[model samples]
Target: MMRRAAFALLAAALLGPLPALAQDAPLRIEITEGVVRPMPVALRFEDAGGAGELLGDITAVIADDLNGTGLFEMTEPESSPATGFDRTVDYIAWKATGTEALVTGQVALEGDSVMLRFRLFDVFAGQPLGDGMQFVSPREGWRRAAHKIADQIYARITGETPYFDSRIAFIGESGPATERVKRVGVMDYDGAGVKWLTSKDDLVLSPRFSPDGQTVLYTSFASGVPQIMSLDVETVTSTALTRDPRAMSFAPRFSPDGKWIAFSRESSGNTDIWIMEVANPSFAKPITLGPAIDTAPSWSPDGRHIVFESDRSGSSQLYVMRADGSEPTRISFGDGGGSYGEPAWSPRGDRIAFTRQTKAGSSIGVMRPDGSGEQLLSEGGRDSGPSWAPNGRVLIFTRLTADDEVPQLHSVDITGRNMRPVALNDAASDPAWGPLLP
Candidate 1:
């Protein structure tokens, strides 16, 4: 039972108390710029399943995950001589092919279960950095096994926990805006095995997972007006966080420890930031007070401070404050008037990602905690709602087509490479990325 606390000072200062605008217009963003190229690497399938092609499928999946990061350019396995897990003795050979790193592995089929053994080596160092381990799983679960292996390899090489085996909970959309149908959907980090946690008949938004990935908090208009609610992912049972009939609450995010929920609450025409104990929702407290609009509160990794979007400066700007709701500081100073919103603090706690709207268009960008070194990563069309992958090097956000007819979930490397849509069978939006699965 982790105790989660919500920090709401920043939100209260911004948007003074106001009701949500009844605009049917879709949110828009622009990908104004990006980085130049991607990194390169070489990967050879370890002959784990002997000389059979069974191992090829396993290695291919692993390669996909690495390549998908846009941080690695995978070398064709056919061009390499390191065919077996134990036969990978030629470091110079792979180095000659311009590969900075190499991955080799083996797979064994034991009854209905399979064991995969893999190793990640630095081609430049000419040595393995970590011990090779074997993963055992049912034969039907090979795909997930491959993801786990990729995660292990990524962590060993980058010193960051991999997000490959994680899951994303987002709103799946269907029907028209006047009578929209939105359901809470959860899927693997790679966009596979999508399962709807809530029926489409409900108007759900801002689906966020608990730190442990067992529960989700979202805003649902199912009860008529928008209200904050929590759902146990395992049981599919939901409980409303607030019962204010005239008040509309949105943008609920859990504290790092998962003991409290920080969200926006609108009551009697005033919207402010508030926190409630998950163990006792009745224990609600307001962290922000004002006549402005303050929404979208994101907690710092240490739980000492919170970053949220507010219009206190006559425009939406990013702000940070102490968890107890004191000492507020504005963090954004870029082109204003277009409104900056949806500030998501990185799990790494080094930077914050946000959506910036200008007359040119809305763009996804990141800046230091003090609002320095702001860099716009994407442009053209709408690329709003940036959520950090568990590794903190990648972001998942909604990219709307030009006509605004289709909204898809796309991922981009922090360096601005491998910007592509996640493969899902349905339309999605307002994606909230979850932490890596343990």
Candidate 2:
């Protein structure tokens, strides 16, 4: 009996923490490849308290979030087998519709507070798939609550990090093309609650958010000279990094730790990459030197390497250098004779996405960190400036129908599928995706 007790204790320790439901195993789907046939799912969201006016919209947001990933085909609630949030789930009936998964939930109002509960189930297996959860918040946090729910579902199903609770800082374009007004604007990942951070009084470009999303780094021509500036997103206040009248600085991005920023500076007809500690811009130092123009520097997630585009090879190409500016190596070899630029390293440190400009057209592509597995994930007139979602499974970039047409934001899966324009105001460029919100 002593040996049995010891064996039981060892087994418990080895199993780690068992989930809320012991019968269900964690979803172990490796999403490295594209799915030709999306798994079909049924979602039944019911309004628990007089069916509040916002319930439908909340549920719609959840469905849109899941469907946008291109991994699931949603079934209309009317045809779903499940009735409501706490119902006795009819899993067999759900399976009969050829649905692999079912989501059932309810939104309720209790004493001026919003309460939501939901569960995901494997229809064919007739069992709960993931741990059920709930979210409670103030009435005004409906959208945030919805996004959190989507994030939970996404993380649970794909076993990947969630990116729905994030924002985008980019240059917003308006007015006539010949005299367009560009300012910094931010919005939710789904393009809601857009807040312009800068007035159209001056031209601002390449607005990048700090790792923590409290501050923004951008370029402004308000002084009649292009200079890098920082803006407090919360306070709406701005400050120029330096008052030097001779040097031109722009295209600034923060390192993963938010301790430093990398940008491009031009002087005497030459441009090079530079890095500065965030606390003291006066101590900035050049990272890449010499005669070739190098700009658009992005730091690897671990902060040990920097990837940027340079003209050192007589044509634009992607190159990687150590954070200390050592052993720079070219990584971009586009379809024989194409040029490459706008390289963005993935937050997961798996692949790098960039703009590949060939004689055929400008498109978006991804390659391994060593420059292998080059797959062009887009086909169109003009696509450039790729930014990875927090999960690194999707990329957002600027897409144009033609050279003269307005550019819009479009997202494509890394597998070269689900290419679609994000619903946002057009004529925008230079997207900088921030980390997930707290």
Candidate 3:
């Protein structure tokens, strides 16, 4: 059972027309679950002039990215004897340290470019997992090279694609509630390289990345009424996706093919889900029409169905229906009087992440689409808005403070492990994660 919180006031302040988008074909991929943990390895830097100084930093970043997944752990270089692939091995020493896999690399100067060669080894089997590869880049491009190495190792070991090189677009907030300021901000998923995409004057919320990662769809109150707006990520130029006088739109999401935009529109006193072709904003149609409040629409992987939150059943609960707004059915049923809202269907279509309220407090949780196997992942304070990482195993959400301070973004594993705050300086919330960029 979940508890209900006093969310009417907060919901009103955040309600508006859902986000808008440009009509582009959606990017589709096979959604699958990942089960294996990241393999732990030890890296002993091979000295190469000034490049050696960056070894510590580069290895640390790789370790952080892997460990952040609640998978890999790095071995202390001091506790292990020095060994290299080209020389005698120290398998017993590594085995004693509880490391199943190991990585070793050396840097060299190749004219104007730096060359890095790294190898992965299976400690117990005493064999190389893969042939060593070399990366050549400008001396200053060591960071990018390191990330590339990490990505390669991850893909090879996990048998799945890696999202380490992708970026995130979200709302950055600051100031008091009455005088609050907000802007669109972009950063690496691991919380590095933050750049402001929009200036802070107008209030902006729910920044979602386009399929191509070249643009973002979000809600803005710059026009007094919340409207769906799209911004080119590279140029920061923006365009309003919808200009409706009779309704306020919010909670905008892009379809899998990027051909249409799905969002919630408040008409008169009723809020319903609607879709508009990206090529022609005037060609809009309502997908959900009823006496109940229908909001927070997320597309299934195939774009054939949508999962959303509705209160037509006397209390707010999760529901699923066709994209055309037919055959609606309730999927969430559990104990406690609390309700569920803000359901984001996983890109893989296996589960849906959402916010659940219980007598103790609000928390983030996930469940299968059929309304079974519901599990609360985080509890206490105020955790809401669960956005899945490119990989379905991780989720990012907002953790609110007791004083109702603006929420900060935090990430946790689906198993309710490895919870940590994302590295951002300002208050942020309503994160809509984009797919991994090519």
Candidate 4:
């Protein structure tokens, strides 16, 4: 009976009216072109129903998900007060800890499922920022529940699209560079729950996720030549999309609506951009002709244009052209005049990410649609193959250094801050981020 009363009081406190300061100007982080300071936040969670390890794991995952973004810094748990789930927050005490935001949650077990109740508070304003919420899922889905909670908090504070609940498809690489073996795999965005989709018998690269996240398009060298193949993510079965033995097709990318596919095909030692109806792969047609090794066709967000790399000007450069092979124009003109390749269109259609190679080394960069405001986001160390996150604010790319030639996946913010290596058991590359789950 006492527990019931405490819960009621806590709920009332969460629903209380916010202060005028909060109503007018709530706590927010406007991510601009400048550097951003990490927001100090405190997290408090209690195991209300003897959840044991499950509760602890859920809490840790939530904290890591938020901290991994390099936006939130968790306060030292020892320095925080012993505020349990049943008590109201002491805003003054929390503010004294130098924490601007606070998150309180409770975990309980009910039958075969786990229930999580959480609330976000703006400590400076001494009021709750948003409504309290509850999430119920099976024990196996605890990580997903934690990600959902992180996404909610991130969206509410940063006013950006949430990417915590998405997945990434990549190539798992092993063995020496002389005899490397690669397989296709998919994992949660944070590198958990990895599942291999293909065997190492055949080499695979560039795993592209379909818009619906139900299929993955990749390049396979199973038949002694690189060809495009589509795999059903659920069944782990693959089917060849490019069957013509006369031409080699690779670098397959799905259109926004999944109705068409854009890829690169090499026939008679000449490469060009091609598009085919996804419903009928046998009717492939060339979108660009007389190409100077044109490849890596990435569709714009609206599917009206494509960005590719070509050497028509006697040097490799980025180009933007219509989807129907018309009016190709050069866009990239970096300061030092380097070669750009592997262009990936941002999901927001505002920027195009690519790899810039020069005399020093290769670096990952992004530019506007018209090739303006080019910014290098990664340091020069053979960085290449950039793939945008679902939110378009972050990108994952492959980085290889002179000392450590082994390729590894790394993520960076669009502003070139918070660069960090992705946690993986082996060398990985060609990261393709999938859409947020339902």
Candidate 5:
């Protein structure tokens, strides 16, 4: 009965208007184009129904997810008040601990399922900021449940879309640079729970996740020549999309609807972009033509257009054309006299990311679709294969160190801040950020 009363009170408090803090502004974080301070938040979870190890694992995953984003620095559990599902949070105590927000939860184990109930509070307002929520899932889905919880908190606090529940497909690299072994692999967005989808016997490149996140499009060299292959992410099975023994196909990418695939087909010493029905490769046809090489096609979020790179203009530059290969127009005009390629359209339809190469240096950069607002994300490196995260706020690409020539996956915020190597289960490149999991 006491637990029921506490929950009711908490819900009622959340529905009521919260008073602004004495400091005049509600304690909230505003993320922008600047160095992140990592807001300090406290986690206070208790195993109400003896959810032993599961509860602890979930707590750790939640913390790690938030920290990985470089947004929130968790307060030491010992320093924060130990509040639980049935107890009211002492906002004063949390404030004293330098925590602006507090999250408390209760985990109950019920047979093969775990139930979690959590609440977030604005410490200074001394009121529940959001309504309490509950999530239940089977034992195998504990990590996903934890990610869902983190996503909710992240969205509530930052007022932005959350990518915590997303996955990444990339080219896993091992062995020496001279004979690097590359395979397609999948992992959680934060680089945990890695699973291989292809073998190292094949040289893999451009591992792109399908729109539904159930399959991936990649190029492999197992047949002595590069060909685009679609791999089922769940079954670990694959089928060749362009199996012409005489032609080499690569740089495969999926349309937003997953009904069609765009790839580069090299035949008779010339390469051009082609779009084919994914279910029936017989419908394959060229979208771009002529003596120039047109490849690395990225679909706009709406799937009406494709942005790619071509060397028809005497140098590698970015271009855009309709999905059906009509009305080709060059978008990039040699940004300060450098070659640009590997263009990736932002998911938000606001920008296109590309690799800038010149005699001076190479870097990863983005620009408006019409070739304006050019911004470089990396200072200097052999950064290539730019792929946008689900939210389009960040990008993951491969960077080859100038000194070692070893390729590694790196992520950079769209604002050109926080360029860093992504933590991975293994060395990786040609990363394709997938949409958020269902």
Candidate 6:
């Protein structure tokens, strides 16, 4: 888990005792299909003490996060009856309005920090969904605290891992198409708190976050050639992981354990998959060597196998092999007459997302590890570079069209519904979703 070393944040029990209730089956919404009716949810957040504008901001973020998922519909807070954090929820009133879940919260401002406490309730069951918890953070970190609250509610209701409190690393592009300037940047998953990690003097591509989310591996042209580099997320410093002058390395990704790095290295004229130890980057070795051009290696969730793009069969396709470069098997058979590349293994270990380019256009699709059950999850115009969320229910990718002709980030559910562009000011590409925060 990734934690903010600079912020003084603490999570503790609520100040007052919470309600105790019946133990019935918890409410859950399994996301298996594309079409889903939004669940009716009522939210009422109170200002505990000295929390004026902060309360509204926090409440808005929580509501937006929940409603944006397309699984939950929030009722107008001003229209709903008021409720206290310590008092019993009005189940009858909420149920009368067809509300299934009710969320109540309180916010207070301390000397230099703010305390946020919240809880969830099953309206029909007349029971508290979970215990109330409080989070204390500096005034500037109120958004982080709000994300935490939203994550808790999401997980408790959906029976899945939360991804609201996560960040994304991407390549920010600007300028004309003939000469564009690119830099590495990081921001909140919803495109807030943008921070640039590199200067625009050199080009950077394929920014991959480490398992711990503290470091980013990317290919840089600072040395006038493509070389793998690692950047510290906190300090904004970078170090070259591969300094070989004879070879060009790119598409770097960390293994599940964070002890090894899988990337593509091209020397002379052939490109192959390579692995290097984080502790000993000076000693790097090739994992796949053949006449075909093999690149863009992605590791399975268990770190036992790797899926990459290869052209050994005379066309670009996806292949899976052991982590040690043995027992190679082709996963994509080109049933659509196009090509595939940039394979990303889902965190759930159930699917592999990839970029499929057919004669019609380009689309983002996914398939089982063995290449069965292939499903295209996007319109075939110009969609590529699919990166799975931490929960594997949604994917973020880049899209381009002739109307705009600029690359931008967009997110879509695995079922190909609710596809929307990410709220970003500049042209962005090569998005990499990090893990949830600690």
TM-score of each: 0.86, 0.89, 0.85, 0.90, 0.87, 0.91
lDDT of 6 by residue, 100-208 (tens): 8988899999888999999999999999988988999999999999999999999999998999999999999999888999999999998989999999999999999
Clashing pairs in 6: none
Q: Across residues 340-384, which tens digit of lDDT does each residue of candidate 5 receive?
A: 898999989999999999776788999998888998888666788
Clashing pairs in 5: none
**Residue pairs with backbone atoms closer than 3 Å in model 2 (clashes):** none
> What are the per-residue Cα lDDT tens digits for candidate 1 across 1-438?
122111223333454433112222347899989955444666556554442565888888788888787666676654665445777558787777777777777787767888888777888889987888888888888888999988887787768778898899988887776776889999988888898988877788999988899999999998898998899888989989888888888899999999988999998888889998999998988898998888899999999889998888898889998887798899998854567889999999988999988887778989988889888889745779999887788899988778746778998877776789898988899898887876
Per-residue accuracy of model 4 over 17-72 as CA lDDT, tens digit each: 34423434546779669746788888888887968887789888888888988999
- Model 6: lowest-lDDT 10 consecutive positions: 15-24
Query: Candidate 3: lDDT over CA atoms?
Result: 0.81
Query: What C-alpha lDDT do the candidate models reach, one value each?
Result: 0.82, 0.86, 0.81, 0.90, 0.85, 0.90
Most accurate candidate by TM-score: 6
Q: Which residue pairs in candidate 4 have backbone atoms (N, alpha carbon, C) closer than 3 angstroms, thus clashing?
A: none
Model 1 TM-score (2 dp)? 0.86
Where does candidate 3 have its weakest 10-residue lDDT segment? 16-25
Lowest-sum lDDT 10-residue window in model 4: 17-26
Off by over 4 Å in 3: 1-40, 47-52, 77-79, 85-93, 108-115, 136-144
Off by over 4 Å in 1: 1-40, 46-54, 77-79, 92-99
Q: Could you give candidate 3's per-residue lDDT for residues 1-438 as a string of tens digits? A: 112223433444466323111112256789698766555677765756556566677777777777776677777755786687467567887787777878888777666677777888888888777888888889766666777778777777776567776777777878888988889898888777788988888898888876778889989898889999988988889999988867898888888888888999998999899999988978999989888999989888899999999999988898999999999999987776688999988877889999998788888999998989999998765899888877677789988877768789999888888889987877887776767755
